[model samples]
Target chain A: MAGHKIDGTAIAKSIRERIHAQIKEAQKLNPRYKPCLKIVQIGERPDSSTYVRMKLKAAEEAGILCELVHLPSSITESELLLQIQNLNNDHSVHGILVQLPVPNHISEHTVTSAVAEEKDVDGFGTMNIGELAKRSGKPLFVPCTPKGVMVLLKESGVDLRGKNAVVLGRSDIVGSPVSYLLKNADATVTVCHSHTQNLSDFVRRADVVVAAIGKPGFVKGEWLKEGAVVIDVGTNYIPDTSKKSGQRLVGDVDFDSAIEVASQITPVPGGVGPMTVAMLLQNVVDATTAYFDKQKARHVVPLPLKQLSPVPSDIAISRCQHPKLITQAAGETGIAAHELVPFGRVSN
Target chain B: MAGHKIDGTAIAKSIRERIHAQIKEAQKLNPRYKPCLKIVQIGERPDSSTYVRMKLKAAEEAGILCELVHLPSSITESELLLQIQNLNNDHSVHGILVQLPVPNHISEHTVTSAVAEEKDVDGFGTMNIGELAKRSGKPLFVPCTPKGVMVLLKESGVDLRGKNAVVLGRSDIVGSPVSYLLKNADATVTVCHSHTQNLSDFVRRADVVVAAIGKPGFVKGEWLKEGAVVIDVGTNYIPDTSKKSGQRLVGDVDFDSAIEVASQITPVPGGVGPMTVAMLLQNVVDATTAYFDKQKARHVVPLPLKQLSPVPSDIAISRCQHPKLITQAAGETGIAAHELVPFGRVSN
Candidate 1:
């Protein structure tokens, strides 16, 4: 039997629609409201430029205003930081994303941290990374790729709880955060890297496998368990003389063989890549909503939600049960009540 | 053949001896040099009190100064925070540890983050946690239990490279950090928690198993691979009529059966418990050294190492290989030359 193809384009389109609807509703609540994202790119490479264009197009499609700031390679780190600081203070800019691999002279950490947590749409800030690691409260922003992988798993109807999931990589942007997210979603996650001995042994036992090792076809079909759900995040370029470009993209897993072993699998080129851009737009919408929510709570801005969609009744019931406890706690801390969103119920 | 028992007491004693030697050397360099730790405790739970006393005793025996600041259970969060801020400013306090489970009225995040990163001996600060998660630089402080586990593994001569290491917990302080640590040390790590469906299957395939799940005997011996190394971090008290106190401490692993299959194992109470305190003392020494190193670089303090132990020859060789590039970069960043410690020779 052929494995089910986990279509990223379809899922990404659905997410974009949801974001579009949300943004439309949010705008109805306030006419001046428009989700916005600022992309700060320094000395862009071909790959970086392609990604930025894709993201900007996706954001516009999702009812988000996108601005791209291009800086020269000779720009000093301080100058780049100043630009980010300006974007951070500009309340009109709801999300800020600094494309990776800025000039070597610039410290990535210094630039990444300069984006305010409210506008850190990439979710690379130390505090956001810390929050993700801690698995406490709602993470301000889940890194796009990992967050997209999660949406795929969720939409696929894969039950992660109690599943033995193996993540093949430990990259800061993808593998590590994805493992943490899977664990938080109730999957038992094993992270295998180059140093992992007998990597096939772990793969053979996993119910779900995510390959982000960057090597082309590093994970073999025989190593995967039959009926495993596979999410391949690797996008590697390899020689393909048959093609006009003399090169093609492949994932860490041998898709042709893995499809035979995996009950479900995501295809390269169309998988994981599109979901990342969709999540970026979603983050902009989220950041915009949060900004307005905080302002409304402070009584500094009027936000009447009469024309917007009402919250689902089931959620309304559950939230009503808590009454004033959450608000009271937030008040005591001098934080606006709307910002203290609680995670499910407190565990004993 | 009986499995070798890892003795925690002996290891702790040896560590204390090294600490004593280091303190003597530090004093020789600067007579007024003193490693000091300030532990703030609130509402003295019996368990918390016991741990605080043990840490204090260990610190005292290691030739370090210790102080306990007790606050009433009813203390407001702000008041507790104020106390922490005061400790943060005390130049003489090299390390600060706020015991966990401070009154519910106070947010743990508030108390934990209140301690400055330099003085956060518990290693719970977001920046420190982020550093540990990224495995980029030397963490300011490794959480006591996880750090102890690393030391135990090293002392046992376990080659972590390419090892199948399964961490049987996902607690922030232990399992998560330990998994990151093991990954950094070149081990393929699987983190299992309450949500894991087939925990036994994962454990049985491990070369090294770290059980920190807190459940008494949650890990069965039959689940361990033969010759696997086991490090149990659980300290659970279960009712036992045979004991005079009507209860006995146990670990997450069934040690009696584990010893039969494992090549090495640590016993409950006699194992991980002592190492936590030992590592705490080690962190204090580290914090103290960094404090003085900074002051000495500022020319605000006189610290000469004429009578102190010379740097280890192997480390010295590694340090000399970096031909001043790191120091130059650090200098450009406004850091003093003396404070620019290099980590081997990897540079642009």
Candidate 2:
């Protein structure tokens, strides 16, 4: 509120534009490049249907292919798994995302894990989490919400290095992963949860406060530092008699007073909400590019407990200096040291 | 010097005593339950060898089994992989650590990943990192350096919640992970590294500073706020005419000046140093416990990307009380429906 409002909707549109351009360029280079996503829906929930419909609309608008898989609520867990396996092995699919809150009858982990790491564009793959922890990526997709938040920050001229950041919440999707993403960017971050003894103490010390707590109007301006950056990740809604829908979408922050104190803030419905879809589109474009390149995206791979898997047995490589070199370290002979790159990678 | 000196040696000794007591109790319960760690050393890097010896001595003193597998510098990476695999499959090896700087010819990831997550008591395994990131490890084994720092802060009576923490470094081993750990503990953390612009401005704002840059005396006291807690993590040695060895160990912080303004400080040799070994020993103990518990340690399983592994599927049970005797109206069954009561599992 203190700073100018960051227009996340417009920004998301711009991001989608960039991704669209990237996909267009890829298509020029490879005729086979088609950004295709397979979305698996598990039940007849109305909310889930609307969300999928919006995604399909966005995909079409972006000139990407969207395939939907519908399953009954009574479907056996094993049967759903078989479907995921078939998709995982399918070469045509670049991204696979099974809708969340899967009927509450199926184990979420089993369903989430069924999507191969490379195809998990939702950034929920175990290996991707591993890589993100290492500041590395294979599935290469950062989650939609966090990625959108990062884009918003960078585009809005918020420098993360050495900034004291307080994230309110620890949900896997928004809070926890965002903390990791921020740290990877060199920001000092603290995550406050229900068990945190006092929340205001952490908030006042923060240069950036990320409110991901699900409670409506849970954070107030008094808890914020003057000129702080505020990102509201909450989408909690409260019932309103004045509205036809009988509800209003609100964020976790007390926007009225907070806007007066904070240097920059994100609005709720028009803010992070729009960016998630944009970020999802970005992932699709990335998968499309990786597909055409005949390459697999990188993701974190968790090894089994106490079981070491031997790496690919061998690879060939060479390193040396030409005869013109004149140092003990660099032999004068054109024939120099032949060495296999360690970690099977060449360091420049 | 301003800050009250934090006695790392004393704290480390106390921690070691606790671990020894734990080992004694465990042995009483299960006579054959001896903690064991296999450390693989490649080449004669003095630093690596010293660390290995220190760890080995500490493990032995704790009444734990310890083995050192020293490999020649010329050994091919494949051969090292085979060695790690052999150890991974060995039940006797509760924890496995391949010493760092494992030759330029070898990949550190290869070696670290090769040690099954269960045996990665050093907390460098991909799964270990993922588990730490997820904040799901019960009795989680944090990477040693960071864990040591956390222990030091805890022992010194510093409350991390709401504290403004500035960590100076982004190394895989200490800076980055420590930032994550501190953030998890509820401190508003800021991480600074080479890419960070306006470095001093960031440091001056912190309530606490963790100086981990390898540079000797890079951070001055004036860079810190008055009453700020300082945790020096540097182990750098610089020329010193007064020392018999012609060099002295200096921390990243200008200790003389920082001590004056800081409320608490950790010394060079005594600070953060002993704690690393203590944490490693603790991890070994944890591995032993986990092995006997017969549960898949998530810390040992690295999710390849952001996605988790497929969970064991859940079956559809009608929500009506008529369908589930486990619940009335099947409302909130409250019981973890998927909870497995394995052969050896205990339930309340």
Candidate 3:
């Protein structure tokens, strides 16, 4: 069977268009308000620069403000943290993303955690990752690559429910979060990494396969179940004597042979790469919308539940039993304590 | 071949003896110092009382102090939280655990999040969960049941690396954290829940199976692969006319048939249940050791690397290039700027 090549560039183009429309609508409502994303880059690695440039360019197309704070490689951990803190406090900055491979001197945790949870657009913060892993409340942001993979799957009209999805990686950024997202979508996900024994056996049973282990051509076509949908997230540079640069990009899956067996497949450079940038732009728009909504809600009193956890069904039912605690909790929301009466408990 | 019945009680006893030895050594050095675990229980469910009694008795036998704070069911969430905050501030309190099912009036997240991370013996806090998910660095405390499962595996002499592990369930306390721990130990981990399609198919291929779904006998004996090691985390109550109580506890797995195929299997009631309390006591001792060690370290100047991230190989090599930042990072650890000389850079 010949596979349908999923066009990530076209899908990303459509997503950016939606983001542009949303930004236009928000700015029309508030003349002074503009959605802004700040990219914090430490040291000038060629790869990092290229990725940052793509993000900035996409932001411009989406009509979102893009600001880059390029710090020297010599910057210390505290110094980079100070920069992140400055971005965190800036009300104009709706989304804050620190480009990966930040100078060797800076701890990734220190840099990421410094970002305000509300403004952590990259979704690299530990609490953000924790939120993603959690089965309940909505995550503030899903990391770009994983979010992109989800979007691609949706656009391809893949019904994830009851699907046997195998993910070949356990990385925090892509594999871990993506698997959680798939699980959240009701897909039966298996995460196989370097430690997996008989990895091919797991791959062969999958209805959907995601290769993101960063090893070029690690997944063979023989491992694919006939008509399985494949999403290759790995981006590795393999030596190519045919090219003047002496190297070419490849994915974790062997695309040439995979196309023959799979019903749907994504190519190396064109598949997941563009979708990642699109998702980043989408996050910026989302963060902007949330910021404006929060600002408007500030003028009016927020609901007591809004101030509490994201999913308050459990607490909402229990709130009826504690009249005094309910009044106090409601009082914080600027509501009249006496007016908020006990709704009576309803047990699940 | 008949399977070996795993002895969780014996393993836990051996672990408790080690904890006793450590506590005795610590007390000999400082007579006033004693490891203490304070459990805050709201409402007296018979099950909760039984579990708490077992934990308290075990702690006493291990020469550890265990205090139970029994609060009324009508107590407000804030009131319980205030009590927890008080314990958090108390230097004498080594570990603070709010017993599960803390009346419907309280949000578990609100109560658990209130426990100080350093003194969070249950390890349910978001940051603690984050540390557990993190690829590097040690988590201060792992949730007891998951930690217990890891101990059981190690004690059984099962090499986790390259094992095909299927975790049945995705609850925060057991399936989720345990999967992360298994992955960290280098086992290929697949987490299956109710949403999983053809659940039996995945279970039948697993080398190591962990059943955490709370349904009794949900995993049939026929579903297990031959010679698989089974860890049943489920303790479901089912009606049994033969029993005087009218109900008996059973695990998620059908032990009768599973034993015929599995190489090793843990029985219901005595398996995971005892190990959970054992790990809790172990955490108390560990927390106490950490507190004393931290106090001792404060008296002596800390090394620069100790103050930094666990892996700083990248930074160590780059230290020569950034002398000013190196001195500043080193300065905070009590080293003079001029005294700390860079040895030269070694590029990776």
How many steric overlaps does candidate 1 have? 0
**Ranking of models by TM-score:** 3, 1, 2
DockQ of the two-chain complex in candidate 3 = 0.22
What are the lDDT scores of the predictions, listed in order?
0.83, 0.76, 0.83
Model 2 docking grade: incorrect
Compared to the true structure, candidate 1 yields what TM-score? 0.83
For every candidate in turn, the CA RMSD to the true structure comes to 12.7, 11.8, 10.1
- Candidate closest to the true structure, highest DockQ: 3
Superposed Cα RMSD, model 2: 11.8
Query: Which 10-residue span in candidate 1 chain B carries the lowest summed lDDT?
Result: B299-308
A1-348: candidate 3 lDDT, tens digit per residue: 689999888888888898888778878888866889999888889989989999899899888889899988977675576577667756778999999866666777777878888888888887777767766635789999999999899999899988999999988788888888898888888889888878899999999999999999988888999999999999999999999999999999999999989999999888999999988888888898887676555233222332455556876756744233343355455443223443432111
DockQ pick, better of 1 and 3: 3
- Deviation from native of the Cα of residue B36 in model 1, angstroms: 2.6
Candidate 1, position B241, lDDT: 100
Q: Kindly give the stretch of ten consecutive residues in candidate 2 chain A with the minimal lDDT sum.
A: A339-348
DockQ of each: 0.21, 0.15, 0.22
lDDT of 3 at A228: 96
Model 1 spans > 4 angstroms off: A299-348, B239-244, B296-348
